[model samples]
Target: MRLARQRAHALIAKSPADAVRSVFDLMENLPEVERLRPSEVGLVLVRGRVGGEGERFNLGELPVARAALRIPEGPVGVGYVAGRNRDHAELAALADAMVQADVWRDRLEEGVLAPLAAGLAERKADTGRKAAATKVDFFTMVRTRGEK
Candidate 1:
């Protein structure tokens, strides 16, 4: 039997809050908004968090959101968002666009393009330790059964 596969990619800002907010906005204005999911869709609140200043403020808190949407057999889904934390709208939109397979020309403009671009410049100036860890290489040898 042949297998069908769908791929989705979301280039989110370094912040998850931003991702959440954009998703919520899309869900709220589904009808008026361009490149959004339909009304009959549903979404699941996967995760949430709140923190600042190197302190554990709140983690895994299920913030109240507006709606969730899933397209039938379309490999695209969206979640409407709202609440006190109204931050990650742009990231959310980008993520939704990726999952929906709808790539808008203005994705970067509407999403992490500007913020991340500026952030990249700022990071260049700072001498902080690199946030990401480098990969360590490891190799294994396999021997085939042969006349030794």
Candidate 2:
């Protein structure tokens, strides 16, 4: 589920405003979710794990937009997204909330999560391909003199 949340976060953050608006517009039977903590912008101290295994270190502060929403069904979903896009934050919280529900969980996964994750992966692959285009390979060949 963490992956789902991360996927939703990435997708919502990168997607155009119109695309997000369209998703919300076409969404049906969405539970009434009210913001418990209204979307707000703040700075969070970024932490890093060196080499993915070393002790954590405070990297720097990053500006983030966060919101929390409570659905009457059960869970209180929180959205923590990079950048100050309030609408994206709200939509993330909404997706989180939807993912919690039994009825809409699969729908949310299929409709939003899957396609967005694929697009994100595709974008990453394209970036890698573009980068690979300029990559240079270096090799050392053993040379034998007349004695050899």
Candidate 3:
């Protein structure tokens, strides 16, 4: 089985509140908005695959926040994110709508997604560095009598 994957909007949806809010704050002419589905928190069943692509199993339930909203004059957007941050979810949905609009798409990409993506990349690099710092490598060598 295959799963559909998306990056940009997912990044936005999962971004920290402060990060998302900074982008939201930059918008000059946000259209009037309405909630198609109010932001809400719930639990979603997490599934895992054994050995990555082997048998699948239920991992557990995880908290998720989701929101669906629309610009009254334009596109609809949806957001789903891990954790229980309703505000983050709403902001993500708003960004999604903005990204879909021709007017806001470029601005959203430049002012919002670009910086968010850069920050995310930096964060990943920092995490990798931290993990590398703690990484331990082990090896065993057979003693040859001749060499000894």
Off by over 4 Å in 2: 1-22, 49-57, 146-148
Candidate 3, pairs of clashing residues = none
Model 3 TM-score (2 dp): 0.85
Query: TM per model?
Result: 0.29, 0.78, 0.85
Residue-level lDDT of model 2, residues 1-148, one tens digit each, is 6776666666777765556667677767778887896799999998999788989999999988888998888877877778788877788888877777777778887777676667667878999999999999999988788755
Best by TM-score: 3
Highest lDDT model number: 3
lDDT of 1 by residue, 90-138 (tens): 2344345434444432442344344544555576555344533444678
Tens-place lDDT per residue, model 3, 1-148, is: 0111245567786568899888778868777789997799999999999879988999999999999999865788788888998988887887777777777777877777888888888999999999999999999999988895
> In model 3, where is the ten-residue run with the lowest total lDDT?
1-10
1 or 2, which is superior by TM-score?
Answer: 2
In candidate 1, residue 15 scores what lDDT?
34
Better of 1 and 2 by lDDT: 2
lDDT, candidate 2, equals 0.78
